[model samples]
Target: MSWSLKIFNKFPINLSSSIHARAFNSKAIGILGVPFDKGAGTRGTDKGPNALREAGLIDEIKHISSNIDVKDYGDVHYELMNTNGRKIHNLNDLSDVAACNKALADQVEKIIKDNRMPITLGGCHSIAIGSISGVLRTTTPDNLCILWVDAHLDLNTNTTSPTGNMHGMPASLLVKELRSNWPTIPELEWCKADLSLRNFCWIGLRSIDYYERIMMEQYGIKYFDMRDIDRMGIDKVTNAALKAINPNGDRQLHVSFDIDSLDPLFANSTGTPAGAGLTLRECLFLMEEVHRSGTLSSMDLVEVNPLVGDVRDVTNTLNSAKAIVCAAIGSNRSGNSS
Candidate 1:
């Protein structure tokens, strides 16, 4: 890498522009908005990326430092047709969902090629299959670690899902061979499906179906449930998650934080809210921990729906979102900088 493109390069910010498409002027942070919500069986989450951006996240990121280049790539475009004629267990209009995810993967791959950290603002948790696949394609398979922070296990496949929601499938797809289930979906096979299950970890989980639980145990994916959190404390649990996700591996880290991981009171806007979830402070501490780890190569802050809540819900979501981003790029000399 050239000295000018080094991670510490200094860059000025222009408040008004899409941050992902333009050539990064410094150690650029690329922002791509995935606005499709059919994955979640909800209408409002489609507005997530725009709402977060309109909440002045760019300005907040810029406020952190002048050396960081933040670029917005705008939202993924997908035409939503009727749900008629879709496969029985499939939630989304499968064809449309596949097309949209392909676009998402392509954009993410481009951002990674630009040598910038892709900070994706998501419409739903399902976008992970695309974004993570893109990153995993560019990065070595053996060096990939995914940190999934959510209240729900999200391990349901089409065969196990009662609601047939694709949002519940990303975690499983990330760790399993999803192409067999969605055989006709070309996008699901964008990368080789022979990836291992050893590099995944889940935190803040309070909800899990029986089938999902069995899968977690079967794969031996390290998960810190709510009870575990109460017993071990956030500091210890967070460290455990970090250690499990990386596992002495050479791969970089990618964190997928579903805002629904926050308590229902704090994240009422999301479609599926678990009874008890992480508090605002715990979530922030988790983000701070990720920042301190110094291995976070990309991040996705997802599932913020402004349409379902009052100003307070919106305010909490906005504040939580900002706090999480700050945690990811926190100042030096804080926490564990390992």
Candidate 2:
């Protein structure tokens, strides 16, 4: 089926102004920055949103398409809670994370309702809980497919997580099927969604936890790890992932990319850097393929820590992130913008 037909059939309310129309008639991009990092174990990732902005992400994106309209919805901020003497189980900073994501969910839903493609800059991978939730509010969960690109599977629930970092458990919390198996966490009650395991596909996995591995196997989640990429090549892996996630070519695509998905040699600033990951070229190719497929609706770039490395290291990683975003938006090094 053609891309226009696929998009029109899914969102008929704006038949004349749907995503297909925007691709040709108008192009607008919404940018929302999530600056909360309580979900993470580290402190510096909170500054990631602005760091990417300072790296000229907006300007680069503008260069992608001449007619593209970009709107910046400023960062979502929260007051830090003092949990010095309190005992938190399974999840850390539960209340703060919930509050921040609630606000994020509202903003993202608004952006999508406005008929704009949302590009969320993240403080941590956990922000995905809100971003995905927000997208679900605006669109049917069964009609969306998530392309999760990360070095580690962020599928640990409170029961499976060795460390109580909420950033590592967004996938587990977002999947509706796992709710029955999840421990009762009242703070996350509002974060629930009907996200099917079949709608998710993982790439760049190299450091999955033991329990996460078990869950992936038991559920038969579609995944293409670094080893698979090495054996089958990036193009084949990308094709296989898109086919599995969007079998009918009508699902909206949401890409939640963790910067750590890149090899440590390219992205060392993230809290968890895994080796034997996708190279910068491979990552760009994957994003470009997704863009060309025309199913992309939203994207999240997370886990970039400017404070973790020297100036050069940070610069390299930041530039890499910008290039990846540009590629996802259909920019080409050969001077073609879409």
Candidate 3:
């Protein structure tokens, strides 16, 4: 059973009108496929990017934003070593992850330096490190902001992670990791310390570990947990997130969206499905609000594990992809000036 990309091609958007000028620049959006799943506690997320691609994400995004110039950069290269014919906790694999991410960071740095937005599709949630870090390298220190959308805090360090899963450590790597092994590559110089803690914000957190919580609080990183979401509502939550990234709405913003943030009922196929999470409609509303924020400089969709999924898994994944496209490309016409 091969995947199909035709499902998304039928809705080509028309950019002949002036309503969506910013989204039409053919040189604006770049797509990359990072197919590594070493970060998750479970396996099989490596097939996520190709699965989404075959699901017709490219043409669907284009149709939604007719003038968008989206290009596919293909998948990052990797070699996995199996222990006794089964994959297990091997910190040695971090080197391969670093190499692939360093390359990805270089690509993203170039895209940002060229003034284009990058939309990265992931193999697992851990890939956000390379993708986001790559873009930060090209930007000024004060101009960087990262909005992490996920159900987990993802702030575990190598020492604190319960499962030794790298996905749990990307947030910690961003802030606390010493970078002794993952030194600055030529393609990703700006990524070193430029992506400071001041540029970070967390939304939709519910499954936080004690250590992760302590790390976040110690660093004073702003986070809106699910309780906050219920109180402030999705619209306000998104506004607060955008505001955190670019308070005055001047600098560029990057959104790292983890699929597991949605309720298991909505996104059951993700590697780590957190129970009490955002509803599908709430996720769409948040995306739409972000679309209107104007500072959506870069985006990433991560952690869609398809191997353990049921029949409805791909369908639900497709819906989430559509929400992302709509948020990135769809414009608010309610108050536009003619």
Candidate 4:
């Protein structure tokens, strides 16, 4: 089962063509794949990056426009941490998670230094610990805002998390508000708590843990769950989210997009499938809006495990992921100017 990429000629969301014309750039994009999945309990998410690539993702992105410069930086590499007799309670594979994220952070920064927008393909949501950290290195938390699109708040600490999967705890690792929640884990010393929770906003959160909800309330974090979308609608909801996080519209924007944000009907291959998630068009519109912002610094598209479902399921998930990437890179449904 294979998939084809197509941009509709009549996209209903008219954010204005002038904006797209001015916003569209010969943007140089660097593709970096973090194939490390130690942060997740699932075994196959590490193959996500290559799965999309093998499905003609890069070629399709290149076909978006002649001016679009896309470079494949290839996959990130890291040393596997040997935890000989060392273990962290309730934190699964801390050593490997730390080791891989450290390397990922380094590469993300390098991509930025080269003036290419970093487009990261992830092993899981935990890869965000590195992607977000790398973006933080170039700008201050005050000047950066992360728009996290997922089914979960991802705000749990090791002790608060029922499952020790580091994927569930990346947000806590990077947020300053949750700094007190974590105990000293020597393996993760390189990863710091830098970004504040206020700098983060979430979308498509329908499956939040108890502790995560408590933390969200305590921090007054702004989020638009599926219920909110069901009310205000995706367009208005997306605009509100942009205004909330980047009110001034000048901050560096980093979007951590988890495929599980989409309903299982569209993305059933992911390890975590939340029902009544965003539709494929809705997710595409969000990416389109992100591109229109022109402040998109980097993005992490994660959690499409090819090994989790049947052939058709894997193909659908990959195609959805590829379409989102294309839209982010300036492929308009109204068609590109070039």
- In terms of lDDT, the best-performing candidate is 4
The global C-alpha lDDT for each of the candidates, from Candidate 1 onward, is 0.73, 0.82, 0.69, 0.84
lDDT of 3 by residue, 73-150 (tens): 778774432323333243425655666677778878777766667888887787887887887676665776788889
Every model: Cα RMSD to truth? 10.1, 6.7, 10.0, 6.8
Clash count of each predicted structure: 6, 0, 7, 0
Number of clashing residue pairs, candidate 3: 7
After TM-score superposition, what is the CA distance of residue 178 in candidate 4 from its true location, in Å? 0.7
- Residue-wise C-alpha lDDT for candidate 1, range 14-35, written one tens digit per residue: 2232122122222478989998
Sort by lDDT, best first: what order? 4, 2, 1, 3
TM-score per prediction, in order, is 0.84, 0.89, 0.81, 0.92
Ranking by TM-score: 4, 2, 1, 3
lDDT, candidate 4, 15-109, per-residue tens: 34312222322378899998877788888999999999999999998888888788999999999766676887898888788888989999999
TM-score of 1: 0.84
Structural RMSD, model 3? 10.0
Better of 1 and 3 by TM-score: 1
Query: Which 10-residue span in candidate 1 carries the lowest summed lDDT?
Result: 2-11
